[model samples]
Target: MNNNSQSLTYTQALEHLRAQALSKQSEEEVPLISALGRIVSSDQVAHRNVPVADNSAMDGYAINAEAQSASGQRFPVVGQTFAGHPFDRRLTEGQAIRIFTGAPIPEGCRFVAPQEDCEAEDGFVTVTRAFDEDSNIRRCGEDVRAGDTLVSRGTLLKPQHIGALAADGLATVPVRTPLRVGLLSTGDELVRPGNLLESGQIYDSNTFLLFGLLSSLPVNVTDLGILPDERDVVRERLTALQGTFDVIITSGGAGKGDADIVGQVVGELGNIEFWELAIKPGRPFMFGSINGCNFIGLPGNPVAAVVSFLSFARPFLLARAGAPFTEAEPVLLPAGFAIAGRRPGRREFLRAKRRFDGAGGEFVEKYRHDGSAQISSLTFADGLVVLEETLTDVTKGDPVPFIPFSQVGL
Candidate 1:
């Protein structure tokens, strides 16, 4: 619980936010069909081995590896095994069984000779060449053993994971319940879209922007609408939301302006763990708690709101929802532009588009404007170019860290 005088480094603040994740962890069992995008609550072990039996991996003739087979040697084909059918009888030396892919191999069979490598005539197979040793057999438990962990706890379930769980015959899985998140936007000069705007009033796009971002997350979001700059109204609305939400995210009123009463009221109602960050476009960001619910206040500028949310709020919320939090690893690429006459001491994220040269070289081109209020820059951007705090100037072709929007689920 500190004020703006104790602004935290990005790494320090993220560590602090993720440390509180376990306090909000809870679990529920859901059908496998409904488990996509949900976090696993515990390790899911395989109940049975994949390919429960040793099966043929190709359409071929299953024969004993020890059989005396040569170019002119012929063996009688006694049985046939399809995918759903199996040859129950045992195989003897110099005997061959016709088998298809996924069909269980007959007893005493150690190799499968591809049908193309042998000649079949009058219920007999003639080996055209030497036998391959123990080939084309999918062994039991090769993919998954009964006691092996199929998926670890805290994994964000994806399609491949669902397939693995299905292979183990799982009808239901245990996952963390979605977090309850509330969204609030504060500004007196803001008006909702589809409404006529008066003097000095602009459409409130932050509500939709934050709503779209929250919709992609594993949380149930409730839109609390917009609040004016009045301190009493902001406090009243925030007070009513204290215990109902797992986290309350508010945009605007986090700065020191006269109208920025949201952070002030939050401090009075609960605790402001940190009120500032050492980063450009999000320096006014705030994180705290009211009653038992967590709170995050974002800057009013549209682009700043986005950067703060992705860099801080997204990871924190995911961690609290039983998923592990890890910082996004940036890909280093050369800068397509130059930076000069910029102050140091704060990390900055610039909206950028990646360009590739004809010879397979890649670089990042930053948006023309660096203002936090430039919302159009985000639309044209494919990702963010990260400038270190100690970096004062960046010449064209200098290597810089870049993080694509897809990496952060944007």
Candidate 2:
């Protein structure tokens, strides 16, 4: 691996990654049920009003308010309107229609009186209390109007967005095709699970970690499995995948060790840049392109690989998948524990979880261990406590920046 380039700070590395040009995936029309997690290809506009007409917001009696229809006034029940069923004729003066929620109000009706406020007997209803005009009535286009954009282009569809689209009468939507990614893990000392481990060998967990992380995004991943630390084999296999996938990701062979051949092979096959980031856990990473396919190399340590993926690779994939790239906002929270002393250089992400104090306040507490090899720390953590490069120590009750796993797609 080349080591001539200067190490970049965490912020600088992120900016560099964001500046790179990306080729978005092609667009496809998919049903609403299949569009979740997919990036919208175009703005989805509502074809009609949300309710389509003025409707009852509650189960009540629809009435036309007049001088005679006051408190204690009696009116005969004219008809009943259920959901998807409207009264056949317009309501007449001094008469009430039993209306259910979501039922369209009759043309001559001006307001709806709550059933609790009216007494109904022998086909006649009496208003026990006076109500305002247009009360309990949901006006047309109150929630959403025709020509309104239900969802904008490049927005990632979530469950709430799906509900809104369905409410606006959208059965199908245009979304970007899934980004094709070729995932590979390289290291002679790594072996797959369910297999006997030889001396100096450990089970390969980075591939499955990357797989689970990528599954949450809109991408189609092809696991290329593990590769031994052989320069010739690595070069030949990577060369064969060039131009076939939108992106190729590899873990383990990204450092400067003699056994790390992924960076060296990539440099020989195509252009590759080795970026030594000033970040704890994942310092060595490679980013570039092989032929037309993009490449991202992460550290071998399970924790480092996860941090690198969340910090760098995830945003790159999202941009390439046609979604607007935006960093997850860090929340300012109090530290429940204290760090007496620490190095003041590289930015660090500590595994931690939020705790409530019962007095209506929350704070973060770091895990007992900070080693990059301890993958179990992440399992017990709800978020990461971010320590800036200049932060030397943390005192209890001090405000620190935190990034929750949910925000970064755990």
Candidate 3:
């Protein structure tokens, strides 16, 4: 794989990344109760039709359609049928079956008159209103037919989906196994939280940010902690992680610096497919692998690391886990603020907060500060505003594409 990304547009880079989704997918069978949020391995087809039989939709009198009636008609009530019980005997013209909601309509019964529209006497029912054709009947296979596709492959199971599958009498479902992912933060000047910071050092918040995002994904994440900028040490750790992880993500040590050894070590150990992206706030993005295990190296700047992860790494990991592609599109939002400067050469993404105004109009406001190192900007915003490369300026009320943190499971 080529490490250099020369003249590669953002769309082209994304396409290349998507093409790397896992060819060898893994899946497991689990009870549907525990399958929420898991991706389906294949289409879940219905084994049996929903509402297996033609049943009553309301508590009523199941009567024959041939019965003569205008406003008044009387018939003897022979038996009753509850939800879980059914009348075994057949109903002729002079007899009506007392049926409750969801009770199977006995043979020869064609319509149901609501219990409220009938007068009941000793073992008999007098009809005050007649049922129309097909009224109060939940026909067999009305909701779902046998062999119909219930849910397609790569679907992230939800409550409604589970309900539908359960109604189809499915007890177990096949879902993709979680991908094994590892995170490594590099930089000698970085320290984990709760430790006292010395001169020229910052807390290792990148690990937590990545961990939080990864926790929400359908992947198993291993925190490798912070490593020094030494080439030997970084190489040793990368070697140790190769066999255990499907993809290892590292932050820092990808730029032109004396301490930047991650990219070089990755090149020596495995391959660097691409090392740079044509985007602002995260240009020093690196995607490569070591010993057949993938690795994505992000910039040391906190915000840049986050943006790169969401824009590039998020989709890559989800696709590897066999997730659906239709859910990855960013939502369109109305731009609330104007662009500050002339059009940038590379694509730009701004952290923004989205909400509606008094008239229920939706808009997104961006943080004025565009520093890659600023962590406050991330917390202050709920989503990101994507500006196209061809776009120089954004006027108020223009449609701006926005990616919500919720979509990435942040």
Candidate 4:
């Protein structure tokens, strides 16, 4: 592996890691109720007829169109049809049957006049409004045809998709099993929150941050907790977890320093493909695979971890889980404030709050103290202002690309 730290940029590192990622290899059957957020592994076809049969679209009378329009168009109300009942009543000419919404349209009925459009007298109803062929008639297979492909493969099932599949009468769907991911943090100077920290020690926040981000994604996250900055211990832990997780994510210990053992361990235990990106706040990153499991080593700084995750790791993970290409496109919006002192040939992501000015104009105000180590900036920011590598100058009103926190799986 190349030990040159200055040769890699964020984009190059991401491309290299993404090239090594393999799509999900396993799948399982899950009930529709529990299928939300899971990726479909096979195309799902409708087993039964949608609507199953012709039904009523409103609470009105079901009558034959020709009979209702005939002379002396007063039809006797023979019976009624509710949502779950079968309307077995046979209709004769000039006879109407009362029907409610979702009730199956009875035999010989070609149109339905809503209750407001008819006048009921005694046991007969008179059609006061003209009837069209499909005024209130919901024909069978109108919304979905039989044996039609309802939801295709590679779709991430949401609540709406579940309902649609249910409408197609599917009780269960085949989906890829959730990928199990392991997270690790390395540093002897880091302590867990709520514990009394020794002098010159800071709290371990990367584990929690990575865990939270991974929890919302369609993967099973296992927090390996914190590991001390000892080479033997770190190497032992990595060796134990190398084959257990689909991917191992670590924070810190990736920079070019004497204590940075993450890159060295990965190189020894597996193939270390890329290191160091050209992106701001996340240049010291490592990506590769260990024992056939993907490995991503992010910067120790909170903002750098988040930025690398959003711009690189998130998309790679999503792709491995069978998400489509369009889902990874970051939402780009106009910059809200001026940005100065940016270096060319490096991409920068700034924390900012996104809002619309009066008259529905979009604006993003860069947060104060946008430092890589500032964890508060991530909490306060609504989105990120993305600066491209080609350009350095940015005016206040210039249109710059951005990614909202919501879009980036935050």
Candidate 5:
């Protein structure tokens, strides 16, 4: 077995994975209402007119701008225009129409004065304020032009995107189908929860943790349950699940142990592209392919598994699912408390809770416990305070880069 232990840096590993994922998958058309959280496979161009036709912006009188004066000009209200109704009547030099919000602007009128600035008497209306040209009138193509691109390709469809498409009269949108993934766990000392744990055996938490994480993504996940640390069983399961899922994610058994068979199985079944990373706690992470299905081998430690999945696997899955390229950009803020001791060459993500100081200033304070196996650290943290690979010491007043979990939809 070739044990080329030259590990890849975090940036290099991400670049390699992105380069390997060159195949663009098929797309499907989904209803506008059901397209939230889905990625658009194609550019969404406006098919019909936006605002559909000329409409009102407010519940006010639609009249000629030149007809109103400072003292007040009164004109008889010939007809009324409500939403979904068009006044075919043409407004003469001194004539005006009573209009509601979203109603089409009547012909021969170029301006609309809001109702608050106007007073209605008997059958006439008086404008007390000077109305500007095109005031309160929503033009036919003001929101969006015909044939304009409402949303570009690779955009993750949010509620705002849906509104934009709906305004363009699009009832359905074309989006990429969710990627299917197969999940597995390997460890002889691991047992599922509710089962009896013998002396040294530990309850398996990686499966549930991974399942919860995968559930939030735009992917279809198939749980392969737990597999023992035997090479043959691992190979058998990999062979059976081949061609069914786009990717396979296995936790544990990537380390250099006698029973660690994931690296060997990846090499035997397919190409082992990379076996290790330079990141802390997740240095033994592995990436490869088995029978054309991508495989990721994560560390056994619960916190390390979640970190690796979030930093590396999540982006790849999103890109394959047609989401736009998104990076975990950090926000620089002052640290609330002083942190002691730091490694110089490797980046560290310390769990932190965000709080506002007495002066109403926001700050992130590091948690007390930061063990790799402490899953509760992540649950209690609002974000991660990133200590750069170059910085060896940090003071309380020093600026630090932090990434909030909420921004990434975690």
Candidate 6:
């Protein structure tokens, strides 16, 4: 935290929180097959080249393209190669080797004539056009060299990364240890998902939303269940979680009131950077540290909790997990409908689903209802049409920044 003492913007807060996370995270060795979504602790250098040798990209005939006749001509098939098998004999002049995809090209072969481009017979093939050198041939070390860096440090390993690592014959990978996160939803009116709800009580959805979001990351989650809106009890429960979790997320009591005691207790015990943000459905947010653990307090409203957690907590957690800090890049989409009378100074994340036009182009149709308490909007929402804080009325066909649910876990 800087000494300026001014309230931070959403971007500034994100930068500050990320700056606090790098070294406190730990590293571990994990099985390669199970490393998806895990952050890489260090750069992974390839032990061996992918393909390991010059190979065929298609089921074709390997021939020395330079040896072909100027007008292109027939060549006798000398030997055959299959995947996991290679023709060891040197390819002779005026001869072609039958090779399957992924089969290592024989010595003296410089090009591959795809089967579709060649007329094949019992033991010979004819080409009407001269085969280009290196065409259809996957060169050795082409995809990855033996000493190339496969995955860099702080990389969030995707499925493609896993495959690349496996190509180097690695059985395990070095990754950061999963962030230990404790999730607790507050409010006495909240009930367990499986339990019967009374007239005044409702089933807890924030926890599920948080869980699903966390499940997509590399984290070990401990659900603290629901906490009643008692100040003392909230403080006691929070104290118990201290020193046990890397981060604690609480969903209620972040406002300014005796009933909203989470922020008060956090401020008393540690610090609260800024609890009130100028963002719709996610204004009452708390971010600070306590007992060596980071804390984030979100608003009690269902949609608010979801939006706040995604917008703020996720970046902090990813930085702590040693993953690269990637801000969600927005896509410009055409508004399917017009919106009016929106207030300024607070960014609005309007719920929207996909709607295709006559030309099959995708556009966004904003949901008519914008209540934070309406949890169903989270389901109907395929993306968020981010209307900026300074702007107001958005007419049809206007360009705006949009983010799909897939970019940030639901």
Instruction: Please provide TM-scores, in order, for all candidate models, with all chains considered together.
Output: 0.90, 0.95, 0.86, 0.89, 0.91, 0.94
lDDT (tens digit, per residue) of candidate 3 on 170-227:
8999999988899899989999999999999999999999999887677888888999
Ranking by TM-score: 2, 6, 5, 1, 4, 3
Which digits, one per residue and each the tens of the lDDT, describe model 1 over residues 198-279?
A: 9999988888999988877788999989998898998899988878999999999887666689988998899885457889
Candidate 3 — what's its lDDT?
Answer: 0.84
Candidate 2 lDDT, 164-196, residue by residue in tens: 999987889999999999999998888999999
The residue pairs in collision within model 2 are none
lDDT string for model 5 (183-276, tens) is 8888888899999999989999999988988876777898888988788888888888889998899899877666788778877888775457
- In candidate 5, stretches whose alpha carbon ends up further than 4 angstroms from where it belongs are 1-3, 67-71, 194-198
| Candidate 4: regions farther than 4 A off | 2-11, 66-75, 90-94, 116-121, 124-132, 324-327
Each model's C-alpha lDDT? 0.88, 0.88, 0.84, 0.81, 0.81, 0.82
Better of 4 and 5 by TM-score: 5
Clashing residue pair totals per candidate (backbone < 3 A) = 0, 0, 0, 5, 0, 0
Best prediction by TM-score: 2
Q: Candidate 2 versus the native: TM-score? A: 0.95
Alpha carbon lDDT at 312, candidate 1:
91
CA shift at 113, candidate 5, in angstroms? 2.7
- Where is model 6 more than 4 Å wrong at Cα? 1-8, 65-72
Which pairs, if any, clash in model 4? Answer: 9-277, 9-278, 10-277, 10-278, 336-364
lDDT of 4 by residue, 1-410 (tens): 54555656656666665666568558889999999988899888887777788999999899875733533477888899899997876676667889999998888887888888888889988887576676788888888887888888888787888998999777889998888899888888989899998998999999988888887667999888888888899889999886798988999987767788877888888877546677887887777778789888889998999888877788778778876533244566667777677679887788988889889988788888768999999888988887778876888888777778888778
Between prediction 3 and prediction 5, the one with superior TM-score is: 5
True-structure RMSD, every candidate: 2.6, 1.9, 3.2, 3.0, 2.4, 2.3
Quote model 1's TM-score. 0.90
